[model samples]
Target: MEKNKTIKRAFIASLPVLAGYMVLGIGFGIMMRDKGFGVLWTAAMSLSIFSGTLQYVGVGLLAAPATMIQTAITSLIVNARYMFYSISMVKKYKGTGKYKPFLIFGLTDETYTILSGETPKDANENKYRFLVTTFNHIYWIIGGITGNLLGQIIPFSTRGIDFSMTAIFIASFTEEWIKKNNRKGAIIGVVTTLVCLLLFGEKWFLIPSMLIMTLLLSIKPKREAAK
Candidate 1:
């Protein structure tokens, strides 16, 4: 009975992810097809990499003659945010046993926000997290394959499709703002991101923003405590 309840809660939590992933995953699929890749390739990437923007960038890389070092640098630059995310999640996922590996692998932006906003209270905490992680992964895979299939038959413009990922992040931030404490942290992230964009432009802003935010937060404790 309790397990059933946890499943229901997890399903509810994953619905938004389902919506976001379906749209963005479809966009990725369409983009991949434009590069002459097909459904199986999309499935493989989605299953193995499971990164949204990185996968998109990686498609271009794959088409080119980029070396291993080049690929590594690009992935590191693109996924710098996860460095901060891993710091906090390390404690929470400490006792997760076998689920730890999968949980860490599947920790996307949306999942991180949801998990960060709240820990399990009444239910089995690890189990709840496992369900949430597993469900979201399944949703992503479904969306990727669905898009791959649809992109084959549909001719469409991918303009503004990338916005779906941004929208999902915004929605997650909003949820954190409304329900979670530490609004200052969220404000700092926004301010740093905007400043980075203005200074660096869109193509070069992400890494700078993440770096500054992590640095600011790292120094926050002693300084704030001194106050």
Candidate 2:
């Protein structure tokens, strides 16, 4: 009974993610199909890699004759933000036992937000977290498969479809901006990103900006505590 209740609650919590993933996954699928990749490829990528932004970027990588070393470097740079956030999640996930590995594997931006958000009193927290993770994964897979199928028959342009990933990031940023009482981090991120863009240009700004943002955000909280 308790397990069932936990599953239901987790599913409910993941509903918003369901809506977002379905759309983004479909967009990714369409893009992949447009690139001459089949539904099986789309399903395989989504099932295995499961990083939305990376997968979106990966379609281009797949089309190009990029070397394995080049792909590895690009992936590291693109997913570097995970390294920062994953540090914080370490404590919260400490005692998750058998669920720890999958929980870690499934830790996407959305899953991180849900797991870190709130927990119910008396609920089996690990179970809840696992269910949420699993549900979100299934959602993405279904969406990817569905979109690939749709793309095959629907004669539509996939141009600009990749923008869906950026759209999700923008929406998430906007939401965080609204909810947080401390706006310094957001301000720092925006300013640093713009400055880096101008200085480093579009192709090279991301890494430098992220490094600066991480440094500043990390320093601010400690200095405040000292005061």
Candidate 3:
């Protein structure tokens, strides 16, 4: 009974992620399909790699005749922000035992947001986190497969589909902004990103923006040391 209740709560908490991942994964699937890949490829990537942004970026990589080193460098640069997420999660996920591996593997932007939030009273925290991760992962896989199947049947322009990722992040950002009532982080991120975009141009702005944001957010304000 307790287990079932935990599952229920986790699912409810994960509903937002479900909505977001479905659209983003479908967008990814459609892009992959338009690039001449098939449903199997989509399913495999969604199941294994499981990073929506990376996978979307990967669609372009897979479409091109890039070498291994290029793919590695591109992937590292694109997913570098996760380093910060993992660092934050280190203590929370400690002692999670069997759940830790999947927790780490499934820790996408959506999953991270859900996990970082509060756990329910009298519920197993690790278990709740695991279930949320599992549910979001399944949603992503299902969405990708569904979109790939649809892509096989329907023909349309994949142009602008990639923007779904950006849209989802914006939604998450808004949610965090309202929930935390802290505007400093958001302001820093926005100002840093715009500055980088203007200085570096769209093609090269992401890495610098992320690096700058991370650096700024990590700096702790110093107060007079206890007199």
Candidate 4:
């Protein structure tokens, strides 16, 4: 009974994320299909390169056929920040036993947000968290596979699907902004991103923008604390 309840709660908590993943995953699938990858390729990509934005970019990489060294460098550049996110969770997820692999595998932006914000009062918090993470991952897999299959027959434009990722980022930023009492961090984030984008342009701006944003926001809290 206790385990069943935990599963129920996890399913409910993950419902919203599941919806988002389905929509975005479908977009990615359509893009991959248009690029000439079949179902096997799509499944492999989704399973191995689970990063949505990176996976989308990877479609182009597949078409262009980068060397192993280039693929490694590109993946590292795009996903370097995941190292930082993992650092923050070291203590929260310590001693997770078999759950460790899944935790690492499912540590996407949405999963992290949901797990980090979950203040579980129940005794099975770890189990519940794991369930939530696994559920979201399954949603992504399903969505990706469905989209790839559908893309074979459907005649739809994938032109604007790329924008869906940007929309997700905006929505996430807005939610974080609204929840925080301090507006200074939010303002700094916006300013830094804009400056970096102007300097670097859309082609090569993300890493630098994130680094500047992190540095700027890192000091704001200390300043607030010192006051």
Which candidate tops TM-score?
1
Candidate 3 lDDT at 208 equals 87
Candidate 1: which pairs clash?
Answer: none
lDDT of 3 by residue, 1-227 (tens): 88988988898878877767877788788898899899999999999999987899999889995789999999998888788789879989998999899999988987887687668885678889999999999999998988877855546665665565566577777887888745787899899999999999987888788889878877774531222
Q: Order the candidates by lDDT, highest first — what do you get? A: 3, 2, 1, 4
Q: Cα lDDT of all candidates, in order?
A: 0.80, 0.83, 0.84, 0.78
Which is the winner by TM-score between candidate 2 and candidate 3?
3
Runs with alpha carbons beyond 4 Å of true place in candidate 3: 152-183, 221-227
TM-score for each model: 0.87, 0.78, 0.81, 0.79
Model 2 Cα RMSD, 1 decimal: 3.7
Runs in model 4 lying further than 4 Å from the true structure: 152-187, 220-227
Q: Per-residue CA lDDT of candidate 2, range 9-51, in tens? A: 8988787788778778888888998888988999999999888
| Order of candidate numbers by TM-score, starting with the best | 1, 3, 4, 2
lDDT score of residue 197 within candidate 3 = 96
Predicted structure with the largest lDDT when compared to the true one = 3
Clashes of 2: 0
Q: Would you list the clashing residue pairs of candidate 3? A: none
Positional deviation of residue 74's Cα in model 3 after best superposition, in angstroms: 1.1
Off by over 4 Å in 2: 152-206, 220-227
Give the alpha carbon lDDT tens digit for every residue of 1-227 in model 1: 77777777777777767767877787777777778788899889888887887988988887785899999999988887787788888888899998898889888887887776565455567888888888877777777777777765656665665565677678778877787656878988999999999999999998899889878877759876586
lDDT of model 4 at position 100: 88
Cα RMSD for predicted model 1: 2.8
